[model samples]
Target chain A: MATILVHVMPKPEILDPQGKAVGAALPRLGFDGISQVRQGKRFELTVDGEVTDEVLANVRKAAETLLSNPVIEDVVQVKVVREGGCGCGGHGHGAGKAEKDLLA
Target chain B: MATILVHVMPKPEILDPQGKAVGAALPRLGFDGISQVRQGKRFELTVDGEVTDEVLANVRKAAETLLSNPVIEDVVQVKVVREGGCGCGGHGHGAGKAEKDLLA
Candidate 1:
């Protein structure tokens, strides 16, 4: 199976009351250094079968068209992780120590 | 500065209508192997000054008590990245090629 992760955020111009509140609260809780807090959404999905470029592209389109609001947010990063085993069989590269695809 | 990322999800017992809808949309998008789709939130915050254990802990507490819903989601992975020169001067270990602290 493949794990597809999606992150969503509000459009930059839009006021994020949730993010603002959290950002403001951090400083009061002894985290005096935090300057900003922008909240976004994450999704962990397990898809059937092997991962393919076409399927992934479709997932991206689905996310853009239906899942997230691109107007307020700038990026929607999607990473596909091949599951099962810890690479003992070398069933494709596992996520291993890495969590996100920054290059994306 | 440090980047504090927070992920949030609905309590498992509660019905996640948003996640459910996205999960349903995936199969229709030609992703036949997908069994479940759960959505969560992500926050990227740039903190002031250096990264410290106490500040990080406070950020976690703030997230739990005010930012995220701990019931449906089991984990909130936080990673501190010191940004500036890409480790040219080696000012503390940067996030570098990896993202997200899965160990947390």
Candidate 2:
């Protein structure tokens, strides 16, 4: 099983109150070096088996139609975080590689 | 500048209404292979400049205290998404290697 991380963030032109709330609170907490903070939603899709192109397309469609408002936000990234288990000795699948391959 | 991705998710024992809603909707949209869908919070902390241990500590603290309720949710993962520009070549600093260093 592999988990796909669909990261949806507010579009640049739109105002993000939630993100701004965090950014506003940062300096008050005596934190430095943090210029801005953007809050977003992450959807974890755990595949029952291997991930395929069709599955990816459906997931993308879900993200676009249900998970987020396309006009107000965008799918910033989509990556496979875990593939079955940790690839201890090349036995586990390459989750990162899978995402790169999908992108390419 | 470096951006830290703080991912917080509900503990296994707790009920995730938001996640359940999505999980239930997947099949309705013809999305197969998605056994479960868990929704979580992703905070992008964009540092003003370089990331330091002090900055990491502060960010972690913020995540623990304000971003999530430690009792019901946990900080599952924290990683550096980007550090400066994409490391296309040797001249560009590594964004991923830095995450490994931090983990180690």
Candidate 3:
């Protein structure tokens, strides 16, 4: 299996209230020097096969279409972190149940 | 200014409903081969100065305590993306108003 990471962030023009709240709370909680905090979404996708160029292209299309709202968010990254892992190693299938349901 | 990226994800044992929904929706939407999807948070922290060891330590503390819920979420990554920018170039301060309010 291959693991792909997709990072989605708010558009620079958009207001991120959640991030703003966290930024405000940081100083009150004694974490200083951080001037700005913008919160976004990260997705880890486990692919069933090798992370070939075709797979990357498909993943990027998915990232832009389903993973982010282009009006307010941007898909900043879609990179492969792991490629061609055996099914029985430390990268165990966490979505076995879901896969069964989908394939059934 | 410096930019630090913090990635927080659901614990492997935890249930990620958001991710499951996305995974289920993918094949229906014509994106295939993805077996699992895990959703998480990505925070871009724009710091006012250089990202020194002390700053990294502080950010790590903040990430664990405020950025992620240690019970269900894990701070998987805390890395510096950009270090010591002049602040007047393409990397303009997007959080200017927030920074001013916080500094005020």
Candidate 4:
């Protein structure tokens, strides 16, 4: 199993009214020190089996075709933070049951 | 300077059409192994000065009030990845120029 983290942000050229609004409000709310408050989203995904290059490529395509607009969004960076191990210093398929149901 | 990372997702009770759509498309796209493909966003903010506990709390409140919907979203985790240093083992006021302009 692998855990992937992804971030999506608007293209730099695009006007981020949400970000701008937050920027304007931060100071008024007593956060005078806060500025340039651009906001985005984060996802933590637990995928069954190894998240290899091919698997991640398909995931990126899915993100592009459905999750975000290619014209307005920049990159869909995918990073594998942890790899599956039984804690015995070896591959663990035994506990994949929980993840299987999630993926199923 | 400090870099804060935030992740936002639909409350588990809410319907995630984007996540569902991507989940359905994954298998057909030949990524048969992929399942439970939920999508969210990530942000990396470079803030000038120290992001103390009070500063971080203010940031979280701002995020709750403007960036995210408290009713529909949960958690505004702000992690300070890096602290100000001249990289010379001391507080760096000299090079905060870039971040200051951004936060300004």
Candidate 5:
């Protein structure tokens, strides 16, 4: 199976209050290096087979119609990720302690 | 000066209802390839300087304390993406139309 990652983030023109809250809270917690924060939604999709163009296209349609608010947000990216469990291209999953691979 | 992407996903044992909903809905919308869906949080942080270890460490602390439920969820991955506006190793941003970079 193929794992697809869909990242839906707010449009630049929209104000992200949750992100602002995180930014404000971080400084208070001593995470000083961050200048800004923007919050978003990530959907990890486990598909039935190889990640083909038609599969990606349908996922894109899902992103536009159901995943995000088209008026205020947009799908920033759609990625074909290596499945979970095996380190195909691990990304940073191998580096993290509690990482879970949905593909597994 | 740097853009760090922190992705927090539920631990494998944790139940992800939203992801299940998305997975269930997609097939109805004709996206038949998706077998399952896992929902998570994506935080785009614009930091003040280069993405050094010190910066990442503090962000890790933030992820542990403020961002996720340590008991149920985990930080699956963290990455430094090319800044918002520029195309340096653009990942998939260049391919999508509504993609927005917080660094810009």
Candidate 6:
């Protein structure tokens, strides 16, 4: 199975109170250096088959349409993680570049 | 300035109602191929200086202590994005490996 990760972040112009609250709490809790924090949603979707381009397109559509509110958020990322690979490890550079192009 | 991306996901044993609702709605909305779905939080932290090892270490601590609930969530990723790089584009290889080692 291929796992797809979709990230939905608040638009730059939108206010992110949850993120602001965390940013405020961090300083109070002694975590320093961080000047800003934006909290966003991440979705991991386990697909039954290979993550073909069509599948990716569909996932992107779902990310934009169902996973995030276009009015206030942007689907910042949609990438596939290889099976058995740690979610953070398999960025799939080729896929990533292609997806970015598609987004552009 | 540097950006750190932290991903926190629900533990496998935990019940994620939000994810389940999205999963159930996908098929109804004509999006197919996804077998399972899990929702998580992604934090984009903008730091005022270079993301040194000390900064990463502190961020990891913050991620575990304040960004996520240890009982139900896992800080699956803590990686730095380069300044001027799109958040999705700067998963530094050496940094990623080091962070994974630190987590291990």
| Candidate order (lDDT) | 6, 3, 5, 2, 1, 4
Model 3 has a clash total of 0
* DockQ of every predicted complex: 0.42, 0.44, 0.38, 0.26, 0.46, 0.46
Candidate scoring better on DockQ of 1 and 6? 6
Report the lDDT tens digits of candidate 6 across residue range A1-104: 66788878898789999999999999899999999999999888888877788888889899889999989998877776766343563222112222221342
Error of 6 at B49 (Å): 1.4
Residues A15-95, model 4: lDDT tens digits = 877777767776776765665655554554557887666777765665555555778765434444456421111112111
Q: Which candidate ranks first by TM-score, i.e. highest? A: 6
Q: Mind giving the per-residue lDDT tens digits that candidate 5 earns over B45-90?
A: 8877666778878887887788888887777666665444312123
The residue-by-residue lDDT of candidate 5 on A1-104, one tens digit each, is 65677777787678999999999999998789889998998777777766677777787788778888989886776666554421212333332122222211
lDDT of 6 by residue, B19-66 (tens): 999999999999999888899998988888777788888899999999
Candidate 1 C-alpha lDDT tens digits along A56-103: 766677667666776766444565556632111111223433333421
Segments in model 3 whose C-alpha atoms lie over 4 Å from true places: A84-104, B84-104
Lowest summed-lDDT stretch of 10 residues in model 3 chain B? B95-104
True-vs-predicted CA distance for residue B26, candidate 5, Å: 1.4
Clashing pairs in 6: none
Residue B28 in candidate 2, Cα distance off native in Å:
1.6
* Pairwise DockQ winner, candidates 1 and 2: 2
For candidate 6, report its TM-score.
0.85
- Give every candidate's TM-score on chain A: 0.73, 0.78, 0.76, 0.70, 0.76, 0.81
lDDT of each: 0.60, 0.68, 0.72, 0.52, 0.69, 0.77
TM-score of chain A of 3: 0.76
Candidate with more favorable, higher lDDT: 1 or 2: 2
lDDT of 1 by residue, B1-104 (tens): 65666656565566778778878876776655567777777777777786677777777776676676565453445555456212111212234343435223
Note the residue pairs that clash in candidate 4: A41-B41, A41-B42, A42-B41, A42-B42
For model 2, which pairs clash? none
Candidate 2 Cα misplacement greater than 4 A, ranges: A85-104, B81-104
CAPRI tier of model 4: acceptable
